[model samples]
Target: MRGGVELTDCPAQVSADFGGDTVADTADTRTPAQIEADIERRRAVLAETLDEIGVRVHPKTIMGDAKARVVSNVDHTLGRAYVRVNGVVSEVKGQFVDAEGSPRLERVVPVAVLLVGVVGLLAVGSRRRGGSARRRR
Candidate 1:
């Protein structure tokens, strides 16, 4: 193709066979009015393409698309987190429950005692610190 014109075998051979008549001479069969009409049609198509590109690259359109994508991602992340948390809660609940879904007092009492021991240690540590500070002052 040269200057947007495709040189098919018929047209190329015609130019070579007709020696003096160049491709341009044969291709210039369209009248001035027809050429102008073609130009106008091409310009309209180009203008529409440019307008579409402009809309796609516009700041508001870009920002809106980005915001929508972020929202979708955040929603997906939160949904996954919620499912994981629910699964963990169910697993923990199962651990604290028996085969019949009754609370396992044996496991519960031990965990309760461990939590109380941790709290008691924290209270004792804080009291010791406070007492040492008073003595230092």
Candidate 2:
């Protein structure tokens, strides 16, 4: 069986190098204020693992029914939109177009704007009926 290819054991330990504590015993070994407090505790554990994967498992996963549209360059402040089926969340501002056509945000809307509020309520109902008409005496 030499060179015939046959290897199969069974264990589940693990640690070799990838476990850390080597690299010449981490060179300087903690200092500079404990390495900036371990880089602020690893950036607060990577901001709580990106808030548990972008605001709690990104709405739950995504891809509710795919093929949905309407996306602008939203910055923040409750432009909320998140959901991802198959992967979990389900639906919330989901999108498509991947191969680099551009737009791509796939869910994450906590309170999106909603069509700039129906165009500011039809611009205050055409500026309140465009004039005035009230003189009860």
Candidate 3:
């Protein structure tokens, strides 16, 4: 019964302003049916919003999101590692090969000799072990 107008007389007369809160608008010309329809529409929107929130909070949805994040991070880290290793390989290749793609014989020859010597040593060591086992038998 505000200002002699009963609250039931005009439901549209009561309106809420954004931020400013509730502000009565006596000039609102919307009929009861329109107001009812609007309320129903808002209710449906709210129900959909709640359903979406429910899905987002579900355990399976949360775990899936977490797994996606982990996989993305792992991929990013592996990509960085690959780039670093590639750079290292390029530097090593540069050391053993000239800009014109010719092998630096001075560097390559020494490394090749060292590898061959190591392989020969391994082969001799294995033969010695085999001989010792045969002697014991």
Candidate 4:
């Protein structure tokens, strides 16, 4: 046996039992050159298959595919977030706008009052801290 393959003197019996025809061992009458050529052909085919598989499972190929998937997911997430934010902004704007597209004073006045109150509280806190720092200095 060569390379775990049985080198038979009567391959016709093997083919008959296997119910298949051999390429180089047709009628069990292959020359040595035919056998060598068949072996070389099979080796070439195997090398090509290995090369293809290597490219498919390569680190760079795998990383590139992963990066593409991540970028696509990020883009989809950002698109959905932008749509949701825009929808919320439009709803808020609608609440503050009248049928004539004029600003509603009632809503605007309350929001402005709240904002001013927050700012005044922050200013008062900062002034008190500044006064204490001045006393230390």
Candidate 5:
């Protein structure tokens, strides 16, 4: 009880009078039983705190927390990307469709024709290659 840890009859009053200092200059007035009880309570609290610290520093716990953070970040990034792509698609569609949602034939026809031309060229190129290979064989 050299420290102010000695149980006081009026701890609140003692703290208020002494600027809330836990160490007091007063003599230990707690009975042996009271001191023992206080020690036991302090030990239990200390043990619980140590257990919590151990769990917090454990490798598995740290890994789990890191994984959760990574997953959250990835999900957030993918969600934003999806929103941006959807916005781009909507903008492109808007350009090809009018206010009434009808296809702008002028714009649609040109794009369709361009795609068809590309596909036709690829098919013809492949067929020529195949025919030449067969003739060589």
Candidate 6:
């Protein structure tokens, strides 16, 4: 807690001070442009987090406010909220608790990074083969 203010995972408490939630919902007074931008950013983060977590966020339709979804499939429970644009998510966020019920040790993985690494290795191997064929000649 820097300066005596503590950081917490509760959205309601944080949102209350901010006049409105920038989590589950957008600030109503914010201009449409501002809200749209916020939504866009949130969606990107949500998609990335979900991808990292290795879960499918089934496509859904939403009109204005950003939507947050909570799922409890594993020992961990997640409460994520994000904005949407054009039937697609624009923002995403959540909290995590590991199976051991320990707050400090949460589980997360980098699926996107793994996929990229795998693809990079395959490309490198293919290129190496072509180079070897030329060198043999």
Task: List where candidate 3 sits over 4 angstroms from the true fold.
Answer: 1-30, 134-137
Tens-digit lDDT string for candidate 4 (52-82): 9999899999999999999999999999999
lDDT of 2 at 133: 38
lDDT string, candidate 6, 10-48, tens digits? 232223234444333323456667657867887999989
Best candidate, TM-score: 5
Query: Could you give me the TM-score of model 1 versus the true structure?
Result: 0.67
Cα lDDT computed for each candidate against the true fold:
0.81, 0.46, 0.86, 0.81, 0.82, 0.50
Question: Which ten residues in a row are the worst by lDDT in model 1?
Answer: 9-18
Q: Lowest summed-lDDT stretch of 10 residues in model 5?
A: 10-19
Best by lDDT: 3
lDDT of 3 by residue, 13-127 (tens): 5544455445656777788788888779879999999999999999999999999999999999999999999999999999999999999999999999999999999999999
Clashing pairs in 5: 4-24
- Alpha carbon RMSD to native, model 4: 6.6
Clashes (candidate 2): 21
Candidate 3 lDDT (Cα, 0 to 1): 0.86
Candidate 2 lDDT by residue in tens digits, 3-81: 2322222122212343445422223444578657766886999999987777534533443323232223342322443
Ranking by TM-score: 5, 3, 1, 4, 2, 6
Clashing pairs in 6: 42-90, 42-91, 42-92, 43-90, 43-91, 46-92, 82-91
Candidate 1 lDDT, tens digit per residue, 14-91?
223334445443645666786688779879999999999999999999999999999999999999999999999999
Which has the higher TM-score value, candidate number 4 or candidate number 6? Answer: 4
**Judged by lDDT relative to the true structure, which candidate is superior, 4 or 5?**
5
TM-score of each: 0.67, 0.23, 0.74, 0.66, 0.79, 0.22
RMSD of every prediction: 5.8, 23.2, 6.8, 6.6, 5.9, 29.7
TM-score of 6: 0.22
